[model samples]
Target: MALKLYNTLTRRKEEFRPVNPPQVKFYVCGPTVYDYIHLGNARVFIVFDVIRRYLQHRGYRVMLVQNYTDIDDKMIQRAAEQGFTVPELAERFIDAYEADVRALKVKPADIQPRATGHIPQIIALIGRLVEKRAAYPSGGDVYFDTAGYENYGALSHQKREELLAGARVDPGEKKRNPLDFVLWKQKKPGEPAWDSPWGAGRPGWHIECSAMAMHYLSETIDLHAGGADLIFPHHENEIAQSTAATGSPFARYWLHAGYLNIDDAKMSKSLGNVLTVRELVKEHHPLDLRFLILSAHYRSPLNFNSELVEASRSGRQRLQEMVDNLNRALPGAGAASAAAESRLQAALEQARFRFTEAMDDDFNTAGAVAVLFELGRDCNIYLKEGYPYQRGLLEKAIGFYREANKILDILEMENPGELEHDIREAIARREKARCRKDWTEADRIRDALLARGVILEDTPYGTRWKKKA
Candidate 1:
């Protein structure tokens, strides 16, 4: 089956088709870089990382571009509070954001463009809007004329009249309509400034993304994604300015990950319930958080609590234990009969089929996870039959686990041969005790191993050990 993705623009699942076959251009809105990324931000990052990985896994040459809004109002205010320049504050948080996502095993974007680095491109794009009369200059600032564009509110599915009724001009603004957004801002005292056609002021928040995305990708890209919160003025303005300027579609497909909640409440500093990836990783494994994020469909809200995270950690460990069992079973065990081996291969093929089917339906990661659990159960049933292990069966199962893990990222299977000899001997001794029904010795050895950061699980086939994450 062809891969299908949910498009926010159309509000339906559409078969994913690239404008240029075998090459996909993907762009996601990156962090503003004023503070450490919170859990909500981390969710969008992880969701898109999985999407990118799956696209590449399906033989698409994906080139992803995620940009940093390095010179926004938040960056300026936080820099002033910290007695540093805007660039310095942005650099600090950029590094923090990268470190946090890296711990979650997210791949870096092929092009990570910063707003400050693309001043010329931003200015050039704004100039085109002004030349086409889609934007106008007023009092040293340039604002996009929302009235000039016929499809200004098309992306967000809001009518022009409805938007205008709810909109109000902010204080110290100079624009004809309240719905019109600023493309360029006049320089102010104690703020970062750059030489531009409008004045020596920086680009506005929304315009920076348009310029950087167009500069790296093209006028019309294949995929554009972000959190659901950005579907409004941020992405809306991007569509208005980009399409109005270039006379082409801004992005062919629009994808948005749903909001992530903390204990059934919106994550916010005012609520004092906001969680950061850095703080969460201090207590739980990064893969645990990734698993929890993937437990829900990307378009559905995910509720996060301490209990939920603990449950996710246990779930991740369950998958990890299966991989360890298969790894340990393969070594020093005789091959299975040809008929038994054929059954194992068939089971593996069935699991792979179900997994792909789940993913093809709009990247349903939660459904894909259910398939993993079924595969784990099948492995246990085969292992408990007391027949000699088939190396090919175990290897094929491991291959399936690793393939799905490339997108899910729930398992961390290290080579057992690389383990220390003493640890290996302890595991072997514990297995022997269990076979001989020496319960006391087996329990004692398990406790000793647990104290040394090695967790042991006894499956019907045998016992497997892994270090605690």
Candidate 2:
């Protein structure tokens, strides 16, 4: 069976197929880099990283491109407020964003193109749109002529009437229509300026992505993904700009991660309750966060709180303990039971098939996680009965776990590189401190673990550490 992906444009799970075989082009909207990445942004990054990782695991050479919106209104305004240069402000937050996501185990994309780096591409795209009469320059600002694009509202599935109802502004209020979005903004006084055909100004929010994606991944991408909040105005405008220039489908699949809500209200910077990845990991482990995310479908809203985080930590602890125990039990001393071996083989086949089947169904991480839990249950039973220690059987289980983990982007297998001597020493010191009931030293060691992307968990069995991401 073919892999399935839930496309936001169609609101349905469609069979996934690359435009070109064996090569997948993926573009995801990266951080704006005006501040540290919040947990909401982390959710999007981790979910899409899993998608790209899964594609690669399935034998596709996935060329992933994620863009940094380094020169948006937010960046400009923040730079001015901080009395810093635009590049300086962007550079600071960009590093913070990278460290934040890395701490969450989001693998870096093959290409992370920044909007500032692709100014020429943005200018060229805007120029083509103007030449085609799909965009117009008004009052020194350029906007896409939404009325000219027959499929302007197709991706967002909102009709002209629906858009106008929510727009509040007059349809005739802009360069062309109410739905018309900005492509280039005229520079304001004291703002960072860039030389463009339209004069010294900066790229608009929507144009950065369209330009950067094309610059890095080509005109059309195999998959274009972002948070569900971006479905309208953002991605809708991307389709408008890119397709207006190329006259081709912008992306084969549009994947969107569900939002993260706090106290049942959507988390946003405007809400003033926005929790950065740094903040969340300070209170909870990265893998615990991943476990919490996978507990529900990506298309479903994730309700986050400290209590829920504690629950996630406990759940992940139980699950990882099972994995560790299973690995330990695999290399047994006794001869294997034929029935045990056969049953284990059957269970592996069933779990593996179910895992792939779940991924094949719109990358249903929730379903895949359910299957993993079932595999864990079966392993518990298999453990009770001593097996012949079939190396192949043991490997299949580990491989199955690891492969499924790629789709959800959750599991953190300890890597030697990640576990340097300093980290090991910290862990040892942490264990000793805890045993000595030196609360201050234990907290100090815990902070050190956080620095290394390993979170310390104190269980009945003692201190167990897992990677932050």
Candidate 3:
């Protein structure tokens, strides 16, 4: 089956055919880079990251672009409060964002353009919009005339009049229509400014992405993604600006990950509940956090709690223990019953079919992960009970297990030598502490391993360990 995506613009699932076949030009709206990225941002990033990985796994050459809105109201305000240059503050937060998302295993985009760095491209886009009469300069600032774009509210599936009903245009600005959004903002004192044709100002939030995405992709992209919160106003404005200027489809597919709530409430300071990756990682394994996320569909709201994270950790642990057991018996994988081969094949095909099918159905990550658990159960059962101590059968089960995991983009194992060395050193240290009769020290070492998210098991013969992250 062809790769299919649910396009928010059309509100339907369509076969994903890249403008240039076999090459996906994907753009995801990146963070504004003013503060530490929260779970909402993490969910958006992970959703796209998995899509990118799956696309690569399916053999598509993906040119991914995610932009940094480095010069926005949030960044300016943060700069003033922190007493740092906008660039410096933006860089700091960008680094933190990268580290956090990398921990979540989000791959870096092929082209990560910062708004400030692409001043020329943004200027060119603004100029084009002006020439097209969709945008106009006013009092040293430029605004896109929302009324000029006939399809202003198309992406959000809202009418222009309906959007203007509850939303206010900038109070101090001259707007022909309430639905119009700013393209360029005149520089305010103490804010980062750039010399443009209109005046010394920075690219507005909506225009920055439209400009950057066009610059990187050169035309309408195959996929555009962000959080569901961006479905309105933000993404809507992007469509208005891009389509008006270029007279081309802005993006063929728009995928938005749903919100992540914490403890029955949104993760907001006003609500008095917030979970930071640094804070959460200190207590829970990063993979457990990832597992928790994968348990829910990308388009569904996820309620995060300590209990859910613990459950995810336990689920992951069961797989890891089975992996350890299977690895120890790899030399004897061949001696399997015919039933084992049939069982492995059926389970593998079912899981593979389900994972790909879920991906086709609006990238249903939750459903995909459910299939992964089924594969795990089958692999563990076949390896433990369905097969004799034979090399070929053990290897076949491992192959089937690894194949299933690959489809889900989960890294199953690393170098055996590397894993063995780490396990040996960790156990040796653990044993030395025990021998010295330093009960506290031994417990400390064990807890230290736990703190690193390496769950431990002591067998009569030896120790087996798994890194939770």
For residues 224-315, write the lDDT of model 2, one tens digit per residue.
99999899889999998999999988998999999988878888768888988888888788888887877777788899888888887876
lDDT of 3 by residue, 1-469 (tens): 7777778888787888888878899999999998888877887888788888778877899999999888888888888899988999999999998899878877899989999999999999999999989998988889899877888778888887888888875677667777777898898886778898899998888988898889889668889999998998899999888988888888888988889999879889888688878678788777778778877888889999999889988887777667656777675345545554467667777876887887777677787777767877877776556545556555655665565455444444442323556756876888887778888987787887788677676654455566554
Model 1's TM-score against the true structure: 0.94
Per-residue lDDT over 1-469 for candidate 1, one digit per residue giving the tens place of the 0 to 100 score = 8999999898889999999979999999999999999899999999999999999988999999999889988898899999989899988999999999999988999999999999999999999999999999999899999999898788789999999889976897799989998899999987779888777888999999999989999999999999999999999999999999999999999999999999999999899998999899998889899999998999999999989999998887877777877777778567655765455577788999999999989989999999999888888776776357777678788889988998888778665555578988988988889889999998999999889888887755556567776
Candidate 2 pairs with clashing backbones? 104-469, 286-468, 336-387, 336-388
Query: With candidate 2 superimposed using the best TM-score fit, by how many Å does residue 196's alpha carbon deviate from the native?
Result: 1.9
TM-score on alpha carbons, each prediction? 0.94, 0.85, 0.87
Assess the local accuracy of residue 445 in candidate 1 as a C-alpha lDDT between 0 and 100: 91
Q: Pick by lDDT: which candidate is best?
A: 1
Candidate 2 vs 3: which has more TM-score: 3
The per-candidate count of clashes, in order, stands at 0, 4, 12
Q: Sort all candidates by lDDT, best to worst.
A: 1, 2, 3
